[model samples]
Target: MCFVAAVVWSLWSAWHLPSWDRQMDLHVYIGAVRAVGDGVPLYEYVAENGDPFTYPPFALAVFQPLGWMSEPVARLVWLGATPVAVVSIAAALTTRRGIVGRRRQVTLTLVAAAVLMVSAPIQSNLRFGQVSVFLVLLAFVDALDLTPRPVRGVLIGVASAIKLTPLLFVPYLWVTGRRRDAMRAGASFAACTGLAHVMWPAASTTFWTDAIFSTSRIGNLAANGNQSLNGALIRVGVVPPERAAAWLVLSALVCAVALVGARQCHREGHTARGVVVVGCATVVASPVSWTHHQVWPVLAGLLLMAGPRRTRMAWGVVLLVAMTFSVGGWLPAGFARENVRLLAALAVCTWGLAPLRHRAPATVGLLPGVRLVVRPRTAMAYAGVVAVAAGAVMLLVRESPVAVRFETPDHRDEALWGAPTNGCEGYTSTLRADGTVGYACESAVDPVGGRQLNFGGGRGGSSGMVTIQGQVGPEVARLVFVPVEGTKALDVPLLPQPGPGSAPLRAPEHGRPEMITSGPIEDRRLPGARGFSIAATSTDHALLLAYGRDGRLISSGGEKLRMG
Candidate 1:
């Protein structure tokens, strides 16, 4: 039933969403992989013309299977594989075959499901085609038994070669005194990393010498680039991006000190549960988390529930909250983004401030919070049950129907580029000024009224640019006129403003006017160029957009044309 519910909910949400991310992040990357496997070059992987990806050659192996199906179906396969991989890992960590009993199964399932639901960052991974889940899962599976310790080490080694973030978990594992596991992880990580280097010699060389070294030094990014709790805090006027990193480091140090203090000062419990707690926080310390990347704590909470009792129940509740936000809450409800950061921070604090020896057995001795105080085996069973139940919920969500639809404006009259009837007449555009024939409705563009512009997905909650195509040379006709909010937008010399020694297209000195455009936008990196891309709904509560070929290529912001 839970599975059915998850399926239903997911389907419903998918259908009703005003605009889906449409594999914006990793989805596009995966799509790129598909293209590559089909013998397409990276240059050909355009979103409009093809897919979006520029992965290392190693990713080629991963994307090869995608070629067996159409793009949409391939995307589904890539996306659909996530739940299975994720839930299975959760079950392995928190629940096992001989772990728990039948009686407590339902409770375990419900709680586990709730926690999994709350894992906000995990969704980001999926949102971006990050594949971090698989990375974490490999480690999670490797960490399971003492027997596989060596192999797990090797896997970590390989994964580390691919992405640096996975390397963070190494200290946690090593500090626990599992030297052999760490060694294996190191070895595997090294081998895989070295292999990646050997295969993508150019990228590998550039990554270490350029990207990695540069990343190590440059600690902050723009608000839009930040994905951490610290980063989000920085975004909402809390702190500067670079300052936030300093504060984060200071805070982590303080927590480490506090955890030591808690060990010597208070003999309180939750030390075991706290271990996983801090793991989540560690993730939030980075600026790269999207939705799926945040799942560390949810997985940790599940494992904790199967560990000691003092804080597991509370942690379980936290999981529920995270899960709630991940599903539909990430959007629609405005608070989901910040809420996710808060939950992750709390987990980090919980673990960081608690005193637990890494090498300590993760057994449930049960000092508090368990009604029956079940045995370790029963606890394991309960945890497994919880994971399965949670998985079921995920499935049900995928199947559910949309409850209510957000209002979608009519778009029927909108001109279709290639459509037969409404097809825009391709013309060798003439550049004219004086706001005369060049800016006229029929000649330059229709000044066409259509539904308000709505970009499917844009960062920072705003829509993308509103684009309309026409013929105009920066020399004569560069003003992109648009009917914005009922008033005419005689957007000034909107092409690249005259560079040094070049002509200058200045905005009018008088009334409010759209920003100026200057310069030719020669190379369009992403597809959907040429055709106008409607960015956002304008202030007039109507629309805003650019016009003409030269109109799109404004060199105003020093932006290199977006490399497709």
Candidate 2:
């Protein structure tokens, strides 16, 4: 009870009192629910911070009730629920096969919960008010067979419906000879997904057809928080065109090794080890496994410590869990440093499976009359050869082009749009198919060239207002909209766009020469790219004039307006 108190108190201290406005994934969830209530299409709902609803429509349906509550109330409820979920996770893991005494079980659960609270992943989940903790708890309960047989797989199914990664467990159960449970999970998943289709027809169609494959909907996969194998490849400068191919090849290899290792562990009566093995593989294979998604490593370490004492495997698990605490963040930032977590996960997979190498029977060579004995080691060697062959097939793979889509203002249907570009690249806006405008960049590497300005507006469908948005070059220090009717000009400041890493522009070191500029400046240097948006009445028309830092006119452009 004291440990549980510590967990709650830790969360309260971290969250602070009387203020719950810290950021990220939770806002996306709240925005998603609000978008549904407003009758907006799920895919079209971008939170104020520019994140979209990346999960399936089933997730949106599950979260719909959150819409009824005010943001503060919802956040409070979510914050309170997170600790309960964490405690439940610890209880589920500890009580799976039963610990000796009631006292020992309670003690173990409390200790595990406290340790989990300190993990970087769980901390991130709490800070963001993310659903990951609950998802992890659900996976743990179902995977460890804590639930009754008839309803055994329901939680895993529901979890996968909310976030696609848990689907890996369905196959894990099947391959481990739990076919009945796998079928139950599959059927439950289909039922939930089918219901979501009935509730949100267009969103379901759009998601299955397009959104599932569009990596752009999620933030930059190369960001440091992303600790997946695909993320590691991306950070190391894998070319864009071949990324999908490489990801497919590597994901397949990892999944094969993981499934084999997990099956072996399950056969050896080490179910916890099997679950941990599969969990690590799922994190590595997924394209956008964020730091908060690493709940599996925490489970692995806890489960290993619960087993026999003083083994090298137990020490390896300790090393793995310590890595999950994220000492890597203190290291110098680069490709290698960025991939520390990914490498640790890969190490967990390898070391967890290392025992299989020695457990295999030792046989000399093939005889003419006798059959060749293929050991686990030899089987693994064959698997590696197959993996290499499959990767070699990447040279022949051809990718089909896919477009990102946004819902029309009417909320009736979606319109295809080009994906957003890195801020350093030049921006271009075009009237796309279905009458919606789209923007694309020329290159991801080249900096924005020359002073450029472009403006466009769309009729605000049912709201009857107008949304005017445009892009300005780095040189544009001031922009004004002068109404053709001689009304007063409206001054709109160009906001500096963050670069590729979404990092803010920084000033030079203290001793550097001052950058010369005129007019009010937000930073010492003007960003290489900037933009602005204005909300106005439909009847308004204005000429856009941009000025330089020295107060000289940079460019003048006419508003290219689109009618409803």
TM-score, one value per model? 0.53, 0.67
lDDT for residue 546 in candidate 2, whole number 0-100: 68
lDDT of 2 by residue, 1-564 (tens): 667666766677557733444646787888888877788788877666556788999998778878788877877788788778888988877776468999998888888888777777887787777888788888778987889988988889999999999999998887677777888999989999999999999999999999897664575676778888777655654434466677877787777667767777777777777877888888889988887798887777776666566675576566556645666766787655777777667656655533557656533222335543436676667767875775455434422222111222232221212222234333344455568544433322222455467655665455444555556766666776543312234567555555444544232233123321211112222246665655545323334566666444456654354232
True-structure RMSD, every candidate: 15.5, 16.4
Poorest stretch of ten by lDDT in candidate 2: 515-524
Best by TM-score: 2
Alpha-carbon runs more than 4 Å astray in model 2? 17-23, 307-324, 329-336, 361-375, 383-564
**Model 1: per-residue Cα lDDT at residue 350:** 39
Candidate 1 lDDT for residue 237: 33
Highest lDDT among the candidates is held by which one? 2
Candidate 2 residue 541 Cα shift, in angstroms, is: 36
Sequence-dependent TM-score of model 2: 0.67
TM-score of 1: 0.53
Question: How much is 552 displaced in model 2, in angstroms?
Answer: 33
